[model samples]
Target: MSVTDQHGNIFSIFNDLLKADYGIWLWEPYTEQLYFNSHYLTMLGYSNAEFPYNIATWKALLHPDDANNIVPMQFKIIGSAEYGESFDTRFRMKTKNGDYMWVLSRGFVVCRDEHGKAIRLAGIHIDTDTSEAIVNKLAIQHERMRFALDTARDGLWDWSPATGEVYFSPRYVEMCGYQPEEFPQRVESWIERVHPDDIEATVTKQLEFVNNPEMGDTFECVYRFLAADGSYKWILGRGKVTRRDAEGKAIRIVGLHTDITELRNTQESLAHLINHDTLTGLYSRFYFDEKSRQLKEKHYPLSIIYGDMDGLKLINDNLGHATGDTLLKTAASLILQGTRGSDIVARTGGDEFTLLLLNCSGNAANLILERIQAAIDIYNTTPDVLPVFISFGLVCANENNTSVNKLVSQADKNMMNTKLKNHPENLAIIRAWIEKRLGSEIDIADTRLAQVHSSS
Candidate 1:
């Protein structure tokens, strides 16, 4: 009987070791049988029902740039060369949602023929490198890394898998706020201090390094480790498999840790600044455009409302720019009050704004329009300030005929039409406000105002 017919349960061999916390794959070269755990499917945002578990199907999801390297390595792992018994590399694979993620793939040959040919294989796929900074943190040369580690308040750890013992550096005691005696010694003791959320990935990387001697000696992972205090600190743990048994299993591992909490916080603050408008606190145009492109592939309706503040130049020219800024801020506040919480309001330009209304119907769009006009009217009810007027145009888009560029063009046309329709009344309102403000200089202002109105 062929191995395919006889060894249906061969995939279960890896189950005892991994317990499904990580994504595992099993294959037999002679039978061409491939099996992947459900975790593997879930990691790529797919279900076995939706995705086939064959080499060709999986290869189709590999990023075009990665397929060239990944496919050849797959074949080489089970080839005639006994030294090529391990498969290791990083590659980008597509998720079910049409996005790509970088994953570290490592495999080992589990069975061989009498002639030392490979017959069966097992491996894991690790979702790593969630952030670019995570990868860049490991780029330093040996001397620079050692010098920095020595200067900074860093920690070191040494582990022996066979003896089940661990060694913690004195710096580790300082960083953890622990006494020398209280520092972790056994592997299990150290494992208890890792934050619950980070324990799985941290342990998996350790297993990956130990099991595959053919992979490089280096191992690195970032996780939150609990300190002697009640708090947890983000630690970048990098290590090397310093020794391996005759069977290629890891015997000793040693590494260092660097505190990265401040770096993480800074990155988060910078990210917020990138995605949000500094002046208005609303989403930026770049964020809006990015989201709009993502939504293009989804089946949903969107209401695009484009708006421009009217008479801003007039206000700035007559009053100071400070007054103009206040007017812009006031407009932004009223717009936010008029729209729903789910709506994405952005300051796209100096005097322009755009709102992306989600799942919005025609009635809902009309209601939003009325609410904004009401807000403007209520603001105008206050005395002494220049009247605030903003011209708006809207277009409803659906899956049938909608795209980012098309929606923008149509909304712009509508906005121009609305602006033309509102210009005369808005001009009159501005004229009234200017007449009221320029009491002593009315004669001089009249000439400039007349010129403005004529040219406008």
Candidate 2:
């Protein structure tokens, strides 16, 4: 309906009451006589005739910013009366105490002549402070929502099933590195980007809720989405089915989409640490133990090799701990490279490493051990602080007759024997190697060693 028809209905309903929360007045351009209800006079701190009674008088009471609009609208209502055009606008008008408050004014030309000219204008005013207060409240709520979305690194979206329209707030598009308008405005755009593995399952879950309408149908899931940059990002989607039609069909869904890429990355990293060693980046002892148990149960023949860096302590004391760590990692890498993909390598303890070889016989284990020794010899020839060599002890076992602890103990004994055979010449050489590899540069005197022995 036109503004004229709307205002006419309002005036017709309340004109007889002569009592509106807002002021009501009519001005005759020719006579300049203004007729105002008691409320109108009260608005200006005047009783009937107590003030100059005309359009000029009322204009003086308008708020400064509203005067410009009020003047033009007044003339429009007067001029457009023959066409039944009316004016409905909101402006600030001065109150009896000279304080200005918002008012909604609707004016119509009620009396028109045969020439289609306007003779008299009738209008009503409603104090819109209550309505204005409501609007301001909504505006504040909108601002708070905007702040929450911005600061929490969250995105928001609205989907209308009936129209097949999807609206994404700026944050939603920006998170995926796209302009707001660049993305398609359909649910298909969202569904098509979900990771293939998760898409069907996620859709099934969503459709279940859609088909069976529930007041609190909260759908939540995490899935990968193809970003505008062509990289896939993990997103945590949470939504509520907000609108359902009379037939109980879902018509709209509104919710938030948060980029959980970083969170997923952190989870993957933690998972890796849980199963793998932090230092050597090999399967951890826990993983080895679990896998060994499974392998034994499955009756798989496995060769277990336990090794320790032969001169780690000497190297650590002579060089630095950093060098010692480098040597350990280097040895671990070589051991890993020598093993088959099916085998597991682990850093079992400080200066100790272990390996589990699947389907490998004792002869095969020996061959691998020789290869590891050869790799160490080659590594030592490099100019950088040569990685101290590793000494390995192997125990071959199968489900027929095997014990993990017994095999490990046998390997440990062999490692001890190997270390003894390769011991450096003098205590000074041992101490020097330890200092250099272990970040400690202290040299112990023979007198101090004698003192320690005597004290013991």
Candidate 3:
């Protein structure tokens, strides 16, 4: 009889003996073929035709946690005689009803080649979902815990104080881009992976929590961990003492490590958005106000450089808003480049900018203003899309009682005076520059008329 006929006959005999409570399977390792009897199909809520009878199908149904650890052992048993005649393992297998059932798989090599290679294997599957054995209960609990951790993208860890040994779950090992055997099961193994800068603080906090149980029930910390690829990843570690000594010292702890790099980056981005101008990449008025208050508390010599763009409205009216935006961005870049990194450059209004210069006198302010003017001169020399011009006013507050607001107002008044004096000339220059750059296709008449009317 053919192998298929023989397997069918054997399956029929076992069906009578086990009364459908158990399932049988036959595998050909050389051919990578698989067979599941009718009882096996029925146990998983599927008919023989509904399920694909293949090794891949069998592997796909195995729980991920079990599969990672078991696949190699399965190969070792079939490929060598080290496992000694038979192998048995308990794992969760997905049923057709979308739930996992605990199963006990027992198998042995049924046939071998002339060279003593195991070509065929046979296994019996026993549903252990309701088994009363302690081992079975533990296996079921472990599978359930694995499901929860995998779903939450968390890695579980258990540490023993007595032996200094640590148990890292498969997911935990994989989180660091490591195989289960790659990472040693020791507390030092985990500590060694912590980034050097964070290790001291993390260890101190952990020790504090361990020494004082009354301080809190749970300990939490966030730090960077070195992954297998040699890159650091942000991890949030949280745990509680599950076992304690008579003196209330922590003896055993169970915890989880979660990858929080994305969340941390998102939080940093939100904080930047809150304190910075979205368009100009300068400090927003809100942040400027806060810094102003802080600088006022320290009685340092402070200088305020108030600036207004000369012809934004003219540009917006003749060219598009996009062109107007370019003018604002260029002004921002020039101010940033001209000022010291310590100086706070802010875009506080539509066409207005302010600089907070700490420990700067009026002489220092003048030099900065000169630097800005030089930058503008260079920009104008390059026949760019738009001509750049800015009116600036500087005021220094050295007195202990001098209010920042008063200095700001004085700078604003001075800036307005300069703007008024240069507005007419700046508009005429802009008109000529645009006409020269883009030719007669652009209209400068309406812009020039608006400038004259505004001056009137």
Candidate 4:
């Protein structure tokens, strides 16, 4: 008294009643004839009166490639012993206007003869063209997305909160020094691999993303990942919540992981350049000033010693600038060796350097300066080059007397005095003597400028 379609869709009830109100098409096996519901005819862009209205009538509407398969499948169904069983097939249907569209035809036998054989078959047919079109379009889109992801060279990760499952693409596993199966499933598995120092903050920030959903997109940070070989590498992780539940909780997170090792190295190199002298690899004048200021603020007693290479200009002019550079580096080495580990020595200018000794008195400064001078004396004894020497001036600063500018000026004045004491002639006197001796050979810049002006 009741019958249902193959997919459990109800069709007819109470032997005399037709339950299907929508368009449906059926074929009578005994007569090899076809009947279409109004809706089924319209689905094929046709009306009952305009169509062939027969079994062969529907074949013309099928796509050329699908016609062979659909016909064979129909024949198989009709010849089978299960006469009340339905048949399903998908093929292109020709409309009244001659346009073809994809459609799925499915139905079950509803009528039988007294001999228990199917005399007529009846069932409901749905317009499955829209669904098939959607499926095909989605398949194309998925393939395009796969190609993009494969070629991008970026690591991708997805996590499902409800299932506690994490999915990583092949590239993502490669970034963390692991094969796909080696990756752990829980969030802690990821957190555990982060460097210890960054682990707590990184974990806390991630939890905050869950607590405040608005911050989910901001959960980007740099952390160290433990490599397969037990070395740690730097990577940057950036993510966004791709799916959320009805409760506003994040159900899925999708993100990228980039190797930022090179970036972090570049940052460190830049910082070193900012804080260090390029030539001698010592602290620069800028760093010297900053460190001194910090020491002063901390109320530490600071002793500064200023020193200059003796005859540096003479070495440059006579022996060449290369010799002069070597002399400067030699002097810096002696200064570094003579001072305590806590002391800071910096090359502030050409042939000029200073040392800041923490908790050092005038006596310690004098001793360190004498040691540097002695080291220079020994270096000067090398057979190929002339003997090199350095002159120094020492100044001690306490809470009452210390300011970076004042301390430097005081040491500089003393350095000049020491220079004069050693050579008995200041730079002015030496310059005058050189000019007197080389007067005829010298091309005076002032006279040259004057002559150029007159010519103009």
TM-score of each: 0.53, 0.51, 0.59, 0.50
Query: In model 2, how large is the Cα lDDT of residue 28?
Result: 41
Top model number, lDDT: 3
Model 4 gets an lDDT of 0.63
The C-alpha RMSD of each candidate to the native structure, in angstroms, is 16.3, 21.6, 17.8, 23.7
lDDT of 1 by residue, 163-247 (tens): 8888776666677678877865777766788888886799866777778887766655678888888788877776767678998
Q: Which candidate is the best by TM-score?
A: 3
Is 1 or 4 the stronger prediction by lDDT?
1
Give the Cα lDDT of each candidate. Answer: 0.70, 0.66, 0.74, 0.63
lDDT of 3 by residue, 1-456 (tens): 122332353233223333433566766564355766667778789865667655888899988999998888888777777565467789998999889988877676654443454555666677775455744544444343323323335566778775687788777788779976779888877888898899777977787788788876456678999999998888877675767898888888777676776667776898899899998999999998998887653646789999988778767876779989999999899888789888989999998899989888889988998998898888888854478888888899886577778888999878877776787788788877666756754544434435645876
The clash count for each model shown is 0, 24, 0, 1
User: What ordering of candidates by lDDT runs from best to worst?
Assistant: 3, 1, 2, 4
The runs of at least 3 residues in candidate 4 whose Cα sits more than 4 Å from the true structure, single-residue gaps closed, are 1-153, 159-164, 176-178, 181-189, 200-217, 227-232, 239-254, 290-296, 358-386, 400-402, 423-456
Worst 10 residues of 1 by lDDT: 1-10
Candidate 1 wrong stretches, greater than 4 Å:
1-153, 160-165, 176-218, 223-233, 241-252, 338-342, 358-387, 426-456
Cα error of candidate 4 at position 25, Å: 55
Once fitted onto the true fold, the runs of candidate 2 whose alpha carbons sit more than 4 angstroms away are: 1-153, 158-165, 195-219, 239-255, 271-278, 286-299, 358-371, 381-387, 400-403, 417-456
Name the 10 consecutive residues with the lowest summed lDDT in model 4: 6-15
For model 2 the local lDDT of residue 357 reads 82
